[model samples]
Target: MSERANAMRASILRSHGGPEVLRLSELPAPVPTSGETLIRVGAAGVEPGLDVRTRLNGAGWQLRFPHVLGASMAGTVISSPDAAAPDPGTRVAVAPNISCGECAYCRSGRDNSCAQREFLGIHHAGGYAEFCSVPTRNLIPIADSTSFAVAASTAVSFGTAWHLLVTRARVSPADVVFVVGAAGSVGTAAAQIAALFGARVVLGSRTPQNLRELSDEVRALGVVDTTTDFAPQLESIAPGGVDVVVETVGSDTWAGSVDSLAPEGRLVCCGGASGGEVGLTLRDLYRRNLSLLFSTSSTFEDLRLVLRLVDEGRLRPRVDKVFDLADAAAAHAAVEAGGLQGKVVIVPESAA
Candidate 1:
């Protein structure tokens, strides 16, 4: 390898176990292949359980080992193999969810359902490095006014929240929405998106401090009511029940999410970061005429909409802190410790 290529650093998971397995190592910088671009990674977002799963190999997906694990990232383009690719030095957010373009789901614009969809840090190498390669089509230009941390943090949290609220549940102006786990990344995003739609948002979390902080942040965006007591609070405010429940915490919050909804209400779930399964009765679901929607990662279009919202100042991510690339192990540990109100971002020294 050339001298210049030998200096790149990355966090690699050679074996599954705990946060200690993530090692900072000097590796050759990635070279952009045809229709791909090499990014000088400025920032990458961390989702606690997801990172832990990748580290522990518990995500129920295949891995090649020695994997780079970052799902959402933002950076400047340093190299591109296609004329249509963003020029070098252009700031961009990398959308990690790469769906097969030839699939029917992709053709219908619901690419999140594409059978052959691949995710960075999971299906392939990802951005826990100084440099990483991504498809040319996945780059979303970042505005000069926005920071890379914000750009990196938005796609998974805000995009998934946007899909759950606007695309799936069809949250509208007249609705009353309850966001379970309203203090976490996806929870905060859900609260903001629901409020942005003019819905009366009820933000709920087990932690009082987290609830207060998140509620304060979203209040400037739109109307919001917060609670630690999920069911009782919803009943007190809406009486009949809420129009939609954004449940991402799973298990612990699942039953309450179902019970808190009104007749024909929608419960949109995209994750279970809490790590457990919950069961529901068929009779109860049918009787309530409730709709249960299971959403996965965001679509390419969803990411674009979120970026547009960020650009318009209608939406913004709550970034807790930025860790240096070498401190990736510490970043994972902090996320696993919990009580974070926003994303833990990792930045390369070159960008810093």
Candidate 2:
């Protein structure tokens, strides 16, 4: 390979402030270390909570300068040292979380809680480049029929939703599930997953048009306009209250989520994009017997399950927009701007 072939284009984050901090630059392609695989990135998904927030405030993760910041990505393997890894030319989606398989959490299938867990983009160089060196274990082979954009958009959103609804909330046909902030990537996945489990899904959003469109698409039981007070609207939609509340908006929708929950309802939270701080009424919580559960990233198994679902057409991954790797700053700006109903993806110029 020539010297130019060894170099790759990437969106480098030199300082934490705004989207402008992400600049296009050329850097040496990552060399695969032992137990790692090198892949040519086809598409990378922008995660608002991880990518935008970390770019704006650093998110307290230790970082080296000129970092890459894509949480989820999919591509074709170029080379691998691990025998278990997919062969060269195989398409795959890279799992975002890296956990120690020896940990108790990992053995018990709660790898998301493994103490030694590290995340792409946050703890290390991720997929904001033309190529990435990924842990061999994190590469999940994707079907040839799966579009790179859809595969790239799957891991974080659908995986997290699967963990939240299936593992944490235990949603079922008997339950009425409410997905807050239904327009975002995770929210859309959560609503679809809930419906897949035969639950009556209700989608809540500040944008009525988006909410209605998503509700119809997901075959949700109803739609709740959350622009103003939504508790009453939720009541009108779900009689007493929903059995399961998928809460991702955090403080912005916390109280309303609690208010819309039925007695002994399970409220599972995975993100706090608006803000983290929220006031809780202890008395109301005890009287209603509400269960407040929190989840982080998903396990490798969760990622696999969602990927299979997406590939089988049981669950759909939404890509709102696709930007070239050189336009990563614009992608981040779009994520930070809000009101997007699907994921914004960044792809290498060649892939674009």
RMSD (Cα, Å) for all candidates, in order, is: 2.4, 1.3
lDDT of 2 by residue, 144-188 (tens): 889999999999999999999998888889999999988888999
In model 2, what lDDT does residue 220 have? 82
Q: Would you estimate the TM-scores of all the predictions?
A: 0.94, 0.97
Quote model 2's TM-score. 0.97
Predicted structure 2: lDDT: 0.89
- Candidate 1 TM-score, C-alpha based: 0.94
lDDT of 1 by residue, 1-352 (tens): 2245646889988888878898999777888889799888889998654566777764787788778999889999888879999888899998889888887899999999999988887887888998889998999998988889999889888988998999999999988888877878888899889878888877777664556766676562222233343666566667888889898888877887898888899999988876568998998999989999989878899999899889788897989978998899898988888878789999988788
Candidate 1 deviant stretches above 4 angstroms: 1-3, 220-229
Q: Per-model C-alpha lDDT, please?
A: 0.83, 0.89
Clash count, candidate 1: 0
State the weakest 10-residue window (summed lDDT) of model 1: 220-229
Q: Residue 35, candidate 2: how far off, in angstroms?
A: 0.7
